[model samples]
Target: MIPVAEALERILSALIPAPAETVSLPEGWGRVLARPVLARVTQPPADVSAMDGYALRAADAAAGARLRVIGSAPAGHPFAGAVGLGEAVRIFTGGAVPPGADSILLQEDATAGDGLVTPTEAAQKGRHIRRAGLDFAAGDAVLEAGRRLSARDIGLAAAANHPWLHVHRRPRIGVLATGDEIALPGDPIPPGGIVSSNAHALAALVRASGGEPVVLPIATDDRDAIAAAAEAAARCDLLLTTGGASVGEHDLVQSALAPQGFSLDFWKIAMRPGKPLIWGDLRGTPMLGLPGNPVSALVCAVIFLIPALRRLSGLPAGPVETRTALLGRDMPANDRRQDYVRAELARAADGTLTATPLAVQDSSMLAALARAGALVVRPPHAPAAPAGCSIEIVDLSSLGV
Candidate 1:
């Protein structure tokens, strides 16, 4: 068995970032930038008006000052002539600030009629003027490589004159479920049969982690069936097989993968409810064998698989986000295995975060997991903790619901 951190290090060290592809800015959000995006043109391009007002020399824009309206400058139509003394240009919002105009008199403070305008309020130099390249300059590094593009980032990139961006390709993850007793959702169940939900859950997880999920057909426990499914999954960049990872008599995933020259990196983790986790390289693709229990499979995916997907998408391998919370009840000493206890979260009147571990932590209980908002992390062999003890927790909100 290996520690969770060690396992993560091993997995990350063996993988490489995915290849790059050019995608339209609309489709670039949530994808990692493979190269820095430089500004192709300056924002605002030239000095412009920030509001609909009269652009004139600041000295002539005093209260009760009168000036002749030489021309109008609405957005996209620049006044060919400059503003001279005692002259003003009617500039609308986003309109270019005509030459010789150093300030603006807002329309609310200025009355205009008969090809002339009068200032009812004082104006100062540079007011209401958007200087050229105020937001960004040409050739500026608008965004750096390894950034996960957000909606705001996309907007900024578009403002930087980028119609498209070079970003990492979303990895293709293949998910396989192996168990004869498991049936697809809505399928008629035989005695003792259960719905095959791991694949679906894993597919959603993959998509949430910025990867495309291809759910393979469920494979029975038979060696041939599992082997055929394994081959198909191996064609993807990453393969995730749920069930048949343990050493049980019926656990045949490892055995089936052996004939395909799968190079096992590690097969167990020093973590409760997920000790049977498996990691290895199958053909040229990375593979992970998750335990059969639903909660265990999903938890391991959150801990390990998501980060792998993030790295493959050219994103920084950031640590799992954790926050400190006070324990709402007593917790017993843990054994050799590190524990991730699902817990409900609440905030106290004093803004203190409190986490209460669910009474039952059975790996198959998806209901309890659903109700949980955080995972209370307990290291292996941790001492018993009384109520009010501070504990580290991973907020599930960060991990897509």
Candidate 2:
């Protein structure tokens, strides 16, 4: 068996980023930008009022000083004439501060008569004005490449006068779940047949990772059937197979794809619950085979497949984020395999995170996995850990993908 780190490195090195495509800002959310977005127009193109008030020279407003009301400037309607020494322009919010206007008096702080306005508060210069290009200047870089656009990012791009943005194309991932005793949900059980949940779980994972998922039909243990399913899965950019990965007597996925140029980069990783993971290339398309166990498949997908999808989307490949948490229970010494123990997370009175491992860690237990908030990582051959000891954990709450 190979180390988990080596297996992940091999898988990533064999993959490539998806091509770029132009999409409107409305559809750019959650997509990685392919190129830097530059501002095409300056915000507030001109000096505008930040409040509905009278715009006048600051010196003209002394205590109880009255100025002549010359003209009114509502939003989008600017007074063509400038404010003289004793003249004031009635300006509303977002209205252009007429030329030569240097100060403003809020309507609530001033009294307006037939032709004159009286100040009830001191007037300050540049207090209620949004200066030209105040937020951003034209031609300035608004956003950098390789950034996953969020709702706020889309708004910023639109404010920068960008109607459309170039983003990486969503990677198409074909998911195939293979097992002779697996049946689709709602199907009549055939004696010992179990519902196949791996495909649905993997499809959700693909979508969360910003990839388009295409779930293929369930392939039985028969070689011909598996081979036909493999052929159909090859059309996608990446193929994800669940089950028939372990070296069991009935395992046939490896043999089924061998004739189709499936170059196995690695077969097994030194990790508990997911040791049977497979990574390789199938006729030029990258492929990863996860163990059939529901918990194992989801955990492996989180640790490996999500990062691969991020890389394919032109996003940075960073280390899997982890946080330190106190163990709520004792754990025995680990063996040769690195262990990812699912645990429930809680916060202490002092805000410290605590992870309590479930009693049963069977890979097929979906109930226990659902209640897990973190995966405490234990390196191969790690010493026994006692309660209250600090340990590294991959926080499930941190998974935005």
Which prediction has the highest lDDT against the true structure? 1
Give TM per candidate: 0.97, 0.96
RMSD values for the candidates in order, in angstroms, are 1.4, 1.5
Candidate 2 lDDT tens digits, 1-401? 98878887887888888999999889999999999999999998989999999999888887599999999999888898999988899999999999888987888989989899999997998779999999999998989999999999999999998999999999999999998899999988668899999999889888988999999999999889988998897668899999989999888889999998999888988998799998988889898999999999999998899889988888887447899999989999999998999999999899999999999999999888889999999999999999999999998767852
Which residue pairs show backbone clashes in model 1?
none
Candidate lDDT scores, in order, read 0.92, 0.90
How far does residue 345 in candidate 2 sit from its true spot (Å)?
A: 1.2
Give model 2's TM-score versus the native structure: 0.96
Candidate 2 runs further than 4 Å off = none
